[model samples]
Target: MDELEFMRGRVYGADHDDAAPRPGRVYAELVGGPLDGLLLDVTDRTERELRGGVVLPTEIGRHGPGGGAVYAPRGPGDRRFDWRGDVP
Candidate 1:
């Protein structure tokens, strides 16, 4: 399924217990940057965070543009994916 599809039709419970970074953010950063993925608006978060997290656009699954709020703080500023290039 696409990112949008995965995110659609339901609300993901914010899980703060997991210290791992948001997977959606990683995918966004990769797809929306030098990684060859479509670029996304930094303001567009990924999803609901349990403790303190980010949210990205839900439509990001298909790799189109904007679809819905996603809550993503790990995009570029979070410093999750480097080596490729400075995110922000």
Candidate 2:
């Protein structure tokens, strides 16, 4: 199967220098952009893990600098990502 198939349309975008990726959340780097692309499942991701925030995988791996940030709750009053079905 192709890589896209593995993503199952859960692919997300992220600049390798995007400061930081929220913990519990996933990010996808762009093919040509400075990012390396990330993937996440908001619906299934645990809320507790997000509380501490997260650095992008690349950053966590030391491939780059800081990335993850304080993971804000996606509650009704908090900032939440709007899924457009485009994945990222």
Model 1 is weakest, by summed lDDT over 10 consecutive residues, at: 79-88
The best candidate by lDDT is: 2
| Winning candidate number (TM-score) | 2
TM-score to native of every candidate shown: 0.19, 0.27
Task: Please give the clash total of every predicted structure, in order.
Answer: 27, 17
User: What lDDT is reached at residue 13 by model 1?
Assistant: 33
lDDT of 1 by residue, 3-75 (tens): 5444332223334254233545433232232222233322344343311433444433344454333333344
Candidate 1 Cα misplacement greater than 4 A, ranges: 1-36, 41-69, 79-88
Tens-digit lDDT track for model 2 on 1-88?
8654443334444343453456665443232122223343344545665444333333432234543322233343233332211111
For every candidate, C-alpha RMSD to the true structure in Å: 13.7, 11.4
- Model 2 whole-model lDDT (C-alpha atoms): 0.37
